[model samples]
Target: MKNKLLKITTNLWFDTQAEEAARFYTSIFENSKIGRTTYYGKAGREIHGMSEETVMTIEFELEGQTFVALNGGPHFKFTEAISFIIHCESQEDVDYYWEKLSQGGDEKAQACGWLKDQFGVSWQIIPENITDMINDTDPDRSARVMTALYQMKKIDINTLKLAYNE
Candidate 1:
């Protein structure tokens, strides 16, 4: 019944921190929760190199989006090719998520509103309407916005707006 109540869900492969990651993710967003948890049986243990009764997977919902975390092993890792984009409405949201997600994460990856969290997951904490603002019909304004954006790490919406208006 793992698929219940979900049309499509993102499955994140983890070494052994499925439950812990699920909890951390749920704590970050509103309308989030740590859902069902599955464990490894004897057969599962043999196949996955995990012990019996060990955590196998964790199901979680972050802001109504479903996600599954599997304790598969170190065979798979997260890359920047795929990232979760958080569309923020205000500077507070951008600041909060940026601070929280990148707490123990990679500071080196912090550029242009993108940061890699401690879990090795990449996140784009961006302000809403940024696409519209940056893609404005005015070429000069658009160029300015792009320049401002390229210089930012955790996107400052106010600064972007100022760049757009200026």
Candidate 2:
């Protein structure tokens, strides 16, 4: 049977590191893999400025989500406006992702569980039960959780729990 196309797939634009980024992402996530890769040809040399046979696009998957990394040149860059969130069940899980994703990243951009990775991609490392805490019927408890959340960078689950209970 043929594979069905995903209704929605994320496409990342890179100056020239599509393949590299794909490799890095796949390596970090389990059940991830690098898929097909297409190279540039002389057909669009004038517009793209990339040489023939250079990597044009790379297809990759992270935890089953499909993404395409395009070497579309320096016309664009990643920004904090778009970020992938990783929900963790424990502090250990949060810590692991925070450490790995934040390596060689912008330290100054770290705030409220959001971080920009080395590839300039923003990511949110948060607790799995964050929604429940924030959706509590008691506004005071939810407000407390938000207050505690704002003061964190990597997101301490224990602290959030404490705030919610108080």
Candidate 3:
């Protein structure tokens, strides 16, 4: 068989709970689906030292990004260096994702609408206009917006605009 090129894939390591995490992620996203669940067993077993019913790997897609979750049994934990940033158009959108991701997890709001979810995933629920404010032609306005963003956990666009005008 010829090897065919495919889409981008990110592998996530979990401690015997990859399937569970995949399900949770699929549930949260709108355009998402579970692709395959591979188990261990038999001579053609996909996973080593595991039974046929044991979850070995899971394939899932979120917003068109493919990801594989491997149940490697907790050799590692998620760190803050890599994270998913969600751009929000409004406060409602921000609240929805923030509430859902923060479930059963810790929360730390960073300046400029960035937050760390319970799973140690960093997310930025920034407003659409943030870019415009930051890239404003007026240096004073841009500086003000930057200052406002530095003091906020969840960005408020109106407040940012007001600051930019100052």
The local distance difference test score of each candidate is: 0.92, 0.93, 0.77
**Count of clashes, each model:** 0, 0, 3
For model 2 the TM-score comes to 0.95
Candidates ranked by lDDT: 2, 1, 3
Candidate 2 — which residues are off by over 4 angstroms? 1-6
Question: What is the Å distance of residue 19 in model 1 from its true position?
Answer: 0.7
Candidate 1 vs candidate 3, lDDT winner: 1
The residue-by-residue lDDT of candidate 2 on 1-166, one tens digit each, is: 4797647889999999899899989888888999999999989788889999999999999988999999998889899999999988899999989998999999999998999999899999988999999999999999999999989888999999999988
lDDT of 1 by residue, 1-166 (tens): 8767748899999998898889988888878988889999888555689988888989999988999999999999999999999999999999999999998999999999999998899999999999998778999999999999999998999899999999
Give all TM-scores, in the order shown: 0.94, 0.95, 0.79
Using TM-score, give the best candidate's number. Answer: 2
Candidate 3: where are CA atoms >4 Å away? 1-6, 42-52, 109-111
Tens digits of lDDT, candidate 3, 46-83: 54445567787999998988999887765688776777
Question: Which should have the higher lDDT, number 1 or number 2?
Answer: 2
Output the worst ten-in-a-row residue range by lDDT, candidate 3. Answer: 43-52
